[model samples]
Target: MSLEQGIVFSVLGITLAMFVWNRLRFDVVAMLALLAVAVAGLVPTEELFAGFGHPAVITVAAVLVISQGLVNGGVVDNIARLLGRIGHRPTLQVLTLTSVVALCSGFINNVGALALLMPVAIWMSREAGRSPSLLLMPLAFGSLLGGTMTLIGTPPNIIIASYRESGTFGLFDFAPVGVAITLAGIAFITLAGWRLTPRREENSADSKLFSVGEYVTELRIPADSPHAGSTLHSLLTTSGDEPDVVVLALIRGEQRLAAPSTYKVLREGDVLLVEADTTSLQTFLDTTGLELAHQAIDDQEAESEGASNNDGLADESRGRNGFRETNGHNDAVGAGDDKAASDPIAKGELHLVEAVIAPESSLVGQTANRLQLRENHQINIVAVARLGHRLKRRLGDIRFNAGDILLVQGFEDSLGGALAELGCLPLAERGLRLGSPRNTALASGIFLASIAVIVTGLLSAPVALVAAAVAMVLVKLLSAAEAYKAIDWSVIVLLAAMIPVGQAMESTGGAGLIAAQMLVLGENLSVASVLVMILVGTTLLSNVVNNAAAAIVVAPIALSLAGELQIASDAVLMAVAVGASCAFMTPIGHQSNALVMEPGGYQFGDYWRLGLPLTVIVTVVAVPVIMLVWT
Candidate 1:
């Protein structure tokens, strides 16, 4: 081997090792590999960044934006709601949800389709009183199966299409092989796959799946509250009709009245700490006209803060400090005790989110009032649940403890930033988003037009999707800020950085060396064995590395193997496509799988119990279809 080939192979080895080790972030690892290759003289320094402009990267980014727009526009959410109405049995629900996710993935990005449907699955699980594990794995696996049905369904197919020397593979070329695999996969999952899922204990450290009723929270009595001037017994009687809604304490002027006497009179400006489910909270709020105590105070503080910034801060500083908070609290103001008297609950996008405090959380040991979370971040911790035990205390007085599940309510737009600031990991329960039929229809139309144009050859895939994303933004289907936030920047960076490194393998003859070695090892084996060998290698590699990176490395080897074996290259390439897209055995294999992991309350080992069988089904079915259709 040449010096360049040797160096490239060594870099590739270390890179693959790091990916499998799962230590560093994959994007960071990919960037390091790119830098290593350039420094090794395998790739020119000038061309290192060229991959950022590559069609594959552009198409992936555009697809992500369009997917997020569809989500924001409520296209997928509407479908999920309709599906929920139709399916009665758990098996039926799994079948319907998984099938729809797969079908959607055939035309759109698989990750996007999975992201949109995951909430629906979680909602169904919550309703059925089943662990999300029963549904999420199937939904994630289904998206992978569905992506195989079209050239644009996955990055590998697009990369494969771009590699074709003759006419590019038609949009529908993948349908025959992909449809067979998808059908077989969907059948196995619905009938047998989900049965293998282990049921996790609801209160286990590994599991956070529980009903909304389990959350303990505090709501304040506004001056207009009907319960004011009534006895504590009267307030509890009016609001605690539902057994799930329990009034635990009353807070008046830094004093906690726990289990107060029934004859105790409730007064204006008093805080009522209660434990209730989501339905009961809404009911109690509507019935008594009590606003979230912290939110009321925070809004007033934000207004004052906004006013001060407007008057004196420089433009850059204003932007920098706009949403900045220190230590999960506002350093500038107290709990805004005086401010709450004036600020009523202004109507806007308020979302109820359940977040688990991470071990390294900054909010630990600090009470909500001490942190001034409401004033600094506009977030109100309405409830706290520790180890399934409810904490009934004044929201301001209860200090946050690590692993405590907090149910916070805040504006829809600020929730992401606030979660980061507080070192909280959001529990996956697909909260409601504001999406209308008009926006949904517009997003659907833009998506269809992009696909139509691509199929008609009016424009290339990347250009068409880019145009669709831009149109979605222009039509206000998604705001400019929303569109930007929708794109997963880490994924984009990984793809851009890895593309040239993949090229280095081909340029330095490393890919050929590997392929030649593979051919020589399999010379005595039958062609069927050779095909399976290629498929198996690609599939295994995909589980450890990025699927696109796996495809880029294996595509050349598959084509080379076909040439040496005197077989149809199309069949071999089809094997590679199937192998690349079917990364079901590990969370790191595909983004769809990882997305469902936490929400489903899954451990790493949980994937293969269901995923292994599904993968076997894909292989057992894909091989014959590839040979029959292509050979």
Candidate 2:
């Protein structure tokens, strides 16, 4: 090989190694590779950032925004609710959910489709008393498999389409090979993949939906409390009695009573250490005229005039339980504006999120009080669940430890940044939108119209999808801020940075050199064998790096190899497209796999149990489909 080809190959090797190691972000590795190629004078420095503006990158970003629009406009909600009504039989549920997820993924961005369905999968697993592993791995694999069906379904398809010179592969070009492969893969996963999943203990902590009564809290008795003189036994029998509410201990005059007397009378200065879910705690306080000690003074001050005359929410039979002006004891936060007017989260700015602390979390040893989380991060720790035990401490005083799951509330825009700073990973996402029927119709209409425009050749795919995204913002289906957040910047960076490096490989004849080597190795093999080898190699590369990067790197070589074989390049390129989209063997292979890992309670090795067979099936099915359709 010449000097330029040797340098390009060396950079490609390093890049692929880093991707597999996964110590650095793929975007970071891509940029380093781009810089190395540019510094070597293989690509011009001025054109290094051209990939950011590439049509494929734009289309990927637009597709993501549009997917978010569908989510925020309640399109996914309607679908999920419809599918949720299906019975909870594990095999049937897996088939239905995975089929739906895969079908949606074929039209929308696969990761976006996975995000929309993950909560439903978790709920299904929880309701069925099954490990999330049974559902999540299949669902993730389904989304990946499904993405092969359409050009806009995944980034690899978009990248490969952009690389085609004849513009022969339009939006639906991938449908022939992709559909057959998706069907076979989905069938395998639905019928057998779930059974191969590891079965583990069913822990409520693993559920993304935080159940009520999982948090421990300390509530203080006030001077005017009617329960001040009531015995603990009588309180339990009272009309406001909640079975889940248990007094773990009592604190009075600096003494903690771990086993307080059942007949013990409550006092104004006494603090009751309680173990109750969030909902029960709210009801307990409202009915008994008790208040949180830390917020007692604030509660009094915030209590409006005639609030005492009103007898608080305890006496009133309001439909909503947790909408108190102060303390907010048991109010459940909804993902959309469906909440009652009294609900604080009904305001568009507020959101409730569950986040788990990572092992190396910065907040590991700090208490909320010390961090002044409310003041500094504008986040409130509503409750905490640690090791299946509810912590019976004041919300502010509970010290954070690794693996503690915290339910925190803050302004919607700041949650992502704040969670990152706290070294926490968000659990299952909740409350995607207001769920208005009108918004759903409008969003779906806009999306379909954009696709129609592309199919009709009125606009390019990137422009059409971009217009659709802009239309979503214009119609308020997604706010400008939300649209920006919907686009994954890291993915954008990786695609943009790697595009130039891919071009450098092609310009330097590195791809041709590699293709020549492969051709010589496969000289004695049949075309079918060569196709299988190409599919397997591309699938392995995609499993390690960003699939879009995989496509960009392999597409040229696939085309070159096909030329050397004196056969039609379409089938080989189709192989590259299909192979690049099926990264099911590892969690790091695709974002959808990574998205389901924590919630699924999955280990690194768990994926291949189902994924390996699924990959083999795709290869066995896709090669013939591509050869038949393209040749």
Candidate 3:
């Protein structure tokens, strides 16, 4: 290799290794690579942050906002929720969610599209008493397959479009082939790819949905408690080993205090109604000066209580006898009247959940009260987590941050639809996760119209996308605050950092070098083989690095190769775009895949079983389609 190639490859290799190790944030790692490359004189100092301003970067941000708007408006969630209830008949749910993901990814950033639905998928898997790992891989694969259809759907496509604009290709040139490949790929996934996804023989399904001991426990407050004289503080804190625990009620006298707060000081004989780990509860009680309130411990009691089928749901625990747990005794009375336990599926009832807020959420600065989240939307904000640290809950008072995780409780419907509307990302659960109902059609219309106008060449693509983003804010599909919250800065940072690297490659003829490598491989190969090789190479890169960054790095080569080979540049660029999105072999390949991993209890190797075949199928389907359409 030449000195420049060696230097560039050395940098790329180190950055990629760190990215896969995940010891450092991908954005931070990419930025470091940018700085190192510039300092080494392999990259221009002035152009280091160019990728940040690149159209692909901006479009990804805008599409995230649109996806949030769709979630806020309840357009996508409504359909996602419908699919959740159709039963755990694994095949049906997999196909349903995979199809939904594919279609959604066509318009929105696939990660954002997947994040909005991921929680719902996990919830549904649990509800149907199945291991979530079985379905998450399929959902991720569907998202990757679906991302191929449109220009803005995946980063590779956007990069391809930008390259095409440099006199390489025409608009709509790749759509026919993309559409064909997408259909055939979807079929392969639904029929065969899903079968390859292995399921662990989980004795209990709740293990996939609940953190197990993360919720079961005991809590005790000391005698002579300060709370004896104080009201539950207006501020609430939801941080604990028990993620599901929120102070629902406190008992001093027979009266119950529902939704007690940080301000509530301690008092003697006060029993705290909390969710906690059984072992941790004793230690916590000893540490806090509280004693365990004993329940009769015997086989008769256990047998009489009966076993529960709701995956350790607190509600099912109470249905055994007249005994029930409630935040406030009065609320329990209300629940008693409502009989929420009768049917766990359809009732508009209270539930506890965790969700992460997307980037730049409008709720960042506003107090939860300012949003009137509970009154206007009917969902309760139990707690908020900024970055990974749980914040002190003034709840109504805490400013929401992009990437903040939220602990919430409320009617499922309101939480599903309205949570997005309230400028929050509900942690993916597997039930029928719905979105806000207030503005579904309006948001969908504006988003689609932006594409229509762009396709008709009436407005520039950037302006059309920006208009859709702004209209979402104006129409209150998302508030100005919410619109900003929806944008992912990590992605933005990664793009900005990598753009200069791409420029450097083009400047040093690095792109030409890679293209030459591919051309050599395809010397006697047909057009289809050339396209497949390019697509496969891009796919492999995406599997190890950020999908967007992969696209930025490889795009110049797709263009360079097209020119050198005397082929239709658009067709070659489209091939690059498809490969960039097909990173199904690893969880680190896409944010959507990462987002689902912990929640679904998925192992790293589990994906390849399903994803490898899917990649092959896409290759088989796409190569010929490109030959037929682009040639």
Candidate 4:
């Protein structure tokens, strides 16, 4: 190999190794690889940032925005709600939810589609008294399958299209193949997926997916607060906001009343136990100066890790300094430390909440700058995920999407309503049903119109989708907020950053060296065997590395392998695409999978039992299908 190629290859190789070891973040690794390429003299330093401006990158970012718009528009939430009312049979519930997921993913973002439906799946598992393991894997897997049947269904397809920018761009050219694979995959899941899952048998009853040692705490509405003059009913009506924060008891000096009336007048020192999101609860605490007799916020993070036996009070020291009464000393909050700056809800009563931001909120692509999510609402967007790809940057600049899972820390008395007003719905198991059942006819009508415009070549796919988005917005079918909330920004960043790296590798002859190695190893093996091997490699790597990164890393090698075998590069590329998106084995592998983890009360080991077999089924089924049809 030439000097430049060897250097690039070594850097890429080590980066892949780090990714596999699961230590450093993939985006950080990609950025480092980009820098190494520039230093190795393969890529021009001036041209190094060029990849960040790629079409795939912009499309991914824009798509996240569009997905957010769709979500804020309320079309997806409407459909998800319909799926929720599908009754208590575990088999029927999984089948129904998966079916809905497939339909939603086909026209829009698959990851976004799954994000809307996962909470419903959790609810079904809890209500049916079945393991969430029975449904979430399938729901997640179904979303991946659903993306196959349409042009705009998934970002990878968009990236693939950008690669073939000058192709005829027929909508159905790939649809038939996708439809066949998706149907076969879903059928396999419906018939055998649930049985493969191991149940998480928790001692707590299944009906309550989330219930802690929460006491009925009270707050005093100060004269200087926002609710000073508001009616008792208006201030206490958190039912529309948070159902878990029940208004169980209200106390005024000597008299303690159960379920205080909405008309009751509010004065100082009124105690209430109202179920609320951390945001809402925080708003309440700061706005009303509420105090808790017992604070469980310190110990809840461990609960997220599934350690329920540790009493909420036993280990205040293991938590942050804010709750370290056991140590009898509070450390100073240093201005210079990064940790201090990063803690959004550092002061006041701390509440950690994981809320699912819908794909349709106007929040997508927005830095907390436009939203001021913390300053105005008193909540922080700590971490966000676009399906399996997680954000590695600041919570402020990371951008929001519909299906993005946000790890937010705030005071419950302060920020709940603002989150809801922003069109973000809590995924923490709520009483909210899908706002309304999906108008299948309207959904079908608008979606088909969008497709027709694209297929007939009347308009570009983006333009057509936008038209449908407008109609959905105007008709009150989908709100402007839902539309913006649906886009996945992390995937956009991963795709944007890594696409150039692939080009650099190819340009540097790194692709040739990798291809030579792959082909020589496969030497006399049949093309089919080689294809399966590539698919297998991608599948194994995806479970460990971020899948988008996994795809970008292998695309060059797969195309190289194809060249060596004298076969269609597209065929091998398709294998890489399929393999990278097929994660099911671990919660860490996919967001839909992880979203269900705590709610499902699943043991981490349970995934392999179901996921391993499902994966094998996908491989066994995908190879023959890809070879027969695509070839």
Candidate 5:
């Protein structure tokens, strides 16, 4: 082999290893490979960054923005509401849910499609008295199947289409093979595949998906309370049959003491920030005679107002407990008419919501205090659950991770928007806007028009989709900030960096070498066997690395193999596309899988119970379909 080929192969090998290691971000690894190829003189410096402006990258970003607009315009919310009416039969529910998700996957970003619909799936499972495990995996897999049906449905398809020399593949070029495989795969899961999923029992009360054992709230000592002068340790000792609650902090007038000493004396009107389950919280309140801080504030306000009306005292007088009162409000506990107007808890508008952190959430590495969640969003992180394990760290100190289940407390009116801005997916049914008919009609019209323009050959996929995204912003379907935030920059970077590296593999004959070796392995086999080999290889690669990277690396090899065997390259490239989108075996294989892991109470081994058989079904169905459609 030439030295350039050797260097390219070495770099490619390391890149694959890094991707599998998964310690570094995939984009960082792709960038490292790009620099290695450029340093080896395999690619010119001028072309090193050209992949950034590639049509495939642009299309992926545009699709993500448009997907966000569709979500903002209430298209998916309306569909979810309709889905709630599907009957309680598990098979029928799985069939209908998977079918709808797959259909949506064809038009929008598959991960986005899965995220939006996941809560619906969870709600369905709950309503039917079944574990979410039965529906979540199938929903995620259905998204993968749906992405195969259209050229713009998946990043891998876009990358594969760009490999063609006769301009990129048309919008519907993939439909014949993709639709057949999708139909077959969805049918299998709906009939028998869902049964293979493990039914993990969630530890819940009142049919809630997440455990409410660690909810944190504040309790205030009344002036006449029996335990007002007790020590902190003594108070805990006497409050319950056992110490089922923990005092996290002591809130004195203007000072907050975290983990206060056991001997610290509790005084009248002192607030104790404690964590306990619902049952235990009630028991503690019943035993200690302490009132909820907010309730005490209200009671005090009524008494102070009564005194002012009867004696004509000033409204700003101090209460007996040394709390400054103004207009029947307490300054000590930070409650007033102004605060009550905005603070949901003060107005009895509080709701405890359970949500899973999205993979692309801005909250992934932030703590509650660092994000100022209570200050900015008026939400409190009451408890957190991770991978079926309850977290014991203090709320403000626990760093958020993707897939972490958070029990957040906030006002019902504005909580949905806050969670959306924080990139969280609520597990419970939320009040999603059904959208004014005009907004929905406008957004849907723009999306369909872009597709129509692409079908009629008026514009390329990237240009048409980008124009649609811009139009969505113009119509206020999505704000400028929302449009920018919708694009997953990590994916964009990975695609742009890996594109040149893929070209380097082909330019240096590395892909040809690999193709030659594969042909030798299948020396006496028919062309169909070679096609299966390519598909299977790409599927395995995608299960380890990003699907787009898998397609970029394997497309050239499939084309080279087709050339050697004297067959149409279209069939082989189609195999690569189908294979790259079938990453159902592991959570690391796809973002859709990871997104459902914690919420579904899935273990790493739980995926292949359904994923392995589904993969076999996809391969058995995809090969012949591709051959018949393209050959």
Candidate 6:
């Protein structure tokens, strides 16, 4: 190999290692590789950052924005509502759910499709009396399958289309092969693939998937309590042996302060909403002399002469260890009281809901305390459930991860907006702003018109999609901020940085060297066998790194191999596209996979039970289809 080729290979090797290690984000690793190539003189300095403005990057961003617009316009919500009417037979439910999600995936961002529909799947599973595990993986996999059907469905497809020298692939260019594979894959999943999924139990109280019950309760401070006048910080830190409880909110008279300052002074008659287990609740009650709100109300009724006429706060039952029980619903404290009208909690405006962190959420790696969630968003995280693992840390001390299910408490009016800003997907269904017929019509019309433009060659894929995104904003389907926030910058950066690296591989003849070696290994093998090898190799690479990165790195080599074999370049490139989108073997493979992990309670090893066979099916089906059509 020449010096430049050696440098390119070494840089790529290290980049792949870093991607696999996953210690750093893939975007950071991609940027490092790009710089390495630039310093090695493989990529010109003037062209170093030009990938940021590439058509593929623009198309990916535009698609994400458009996906968000569809979401805001309630386009998917209408479809999600239809799933409730599907009969409860497991086979029928799986088929309907997967088919709908897959179809949606063809046009919208697959991850976005999964996020919007995941709660619906869990709801369907619960209603059908089945484990969520049975449906969630299939749903995630179906989204992946659906993405392979269209150019704008997934970032990998967009990246692959950008590799065509003639121009990007038309809107429905991938339909032939993609539709075949998606139908086959969905059929397999609905028939027998879902049976392979592990049946993990779900917390079924009040239709909630997580156990967020007595862990969060309200305690009232009595006038004689020794800790009544102490600051919250002082009370918690009084002794190292104090129970590991977090005060989520402080209620004084009609005022509710969520995530109150640690230094705020506690007053007699103040109610504290805290998160603690039974043992900690008892310990805190004993050591601090704080009484459960129900107990305190009973005591006040007993002491007053005419208390029988007052509202029956004493009627509220207490759970074990004197904690105020919410039964299954996380109803607010002081509910049903006219005196507390100023407080959202007392007015029944406060709602407790569960949300899952999205893979690209800004809240990942952040602590509730650090994000100032209660202060900034007027919301507090009462409890967290991660991959079926019980969290032992205090609520504020726990760091958030993608797929962590959080039980959040906030006013119903602002809760949805807060979760959206935080990049969380609510597990509970809520009213959609654009669920109205007019808005839905507008969003659908704009999207279809853009597809028409691309189909008729009126505009290129990126330009048409970008125009659609702008029209959506102009029509007020989604606001400017929401449109900007919808773009997954990590994927964008990874693509921008890796595009040039892929070019450098070809520019330095590194891709040629690798393709030559691949040819030698497959010299005795037929062209079909070589195609399978390329497809399978790309599939494996995608399982470890970002799918877009996998495509960018592999497309050049696939093209070179096709040239060497004197076969159609489109056929080889199509193989790479299919393989890159087939990252079903591991949760790390795709955002859709990881997004469902905790919700489904899937172990790392559980994915391959279905993913392995599905991947084999994709490889088996994709090769012949590509050969027959593209060749």
Pick by lDDT: which candidate is best? 6
Judged by whole-model lDDT over C-alpha atoms, candidate 4 comes out at 0.61
Question: Which ten contiguous residues of candidate 6 have the minimum total lDDT?
Answer: 319-328
TM-score of every prediction relative to native: 0.72, 0.74, 0.76, 0.67, 0.83, 0.92
Candidate no. 6 TM-score: 0.92
Comparing 5 with 6 on lDDT, the higher-scoring candidate is 6
Query: Each candidate: what lDDT?
Result: 0.73, 0.76, 0.66, 0.61, 0.82, 0.83
Tell me model 3's lDDT, rounded to 2 decimals.
Answer: 0.66
TM-score of model 1 vs. true structure:
0.72
Candidate 1 vs candidate 5: which has greater TM-score? 5
lDDT of 1 by residue, 1-631 (tens): 9999989888888988998896667789899999999888888888999989988788878887888788778887677667668554878988998899999899777876876677677667766667777888899899999999987788888777766656667778999999999999999999888898767545432233333323445577778777889986576557545233545445677554443445678888887655565566677677767776566445565688763322211122321211123222211111233342222223334445666675335787888757767557767676777645556555556777655777776655677668855767565533545478888888899999998998999998888889999999999887888777666677788888888888898888777788789878988987778878888889999998888878877887787777777878888888888998999888779878766665566777888899888888888899988888888
Taking the tens digit of each residue's C-alpha lDDT, what string does model 6 give over 391-483?
Answer: 777776788888898888777678888998888988744443446889899999999999999989988888999999999999999889888
**Tens digits of per-residue lDDT for model 3, 1-631:** 5888777877877887887787667889989989878888986656676677777678777877887787778787776667746777877877788888888888777776787677767667766777666777778777777777777777667666776645422335556766777777677777777777766555565532223223432233545644455543411222222222344445554444434445566566665655444443444444444444323222345677874322222333343221233331112211222343332322444556676554335565566667766446655565565533455434455766545566665554566666666545555442443445557778778987987898788887777788899898888777887777677777788878877877777777778988888788877887777888788988999899887788877788888888888888767877888888888888778866766665455667877887788788888888887777776
TM match of model 4 to true structure: 0.67
Candidate ranking (TM-score, best to worst):
6, 5, 3, 2, 1, 4
Clashes by residue pair, model 2: 213-276, 213-277, 335-431
lDDT measured at residue 313 in model 2 versus the true structure, 0 to 100:
25
User: How many clashes would you count in candidate 4?
Assistant: 66
lDDT, residue 132, candidate 5: 90
Ranked candidates, highest lDDT first: 6, 5, 2, 1, 3, 4
Better of 2 and 4 by TM-score: 2
What's the C-alpha lDDT at position 565 in model 2?
Answer: 91
For model 1, where is the 10-residue window of minimal lDDT? Answer: 326-335
**Which regions of candidate 5 deviate over 4 angstroms?**
202-205, 209-218, 221-348
Which lDDT tens digits does candidate 5 get at residues 20-62?
9987789999999999999889999999999999999999999
Off by over 4 Å in 2: 203-215, 219-373, 376-378, 381-434
Error of 2 at 533 (Å): 1.0
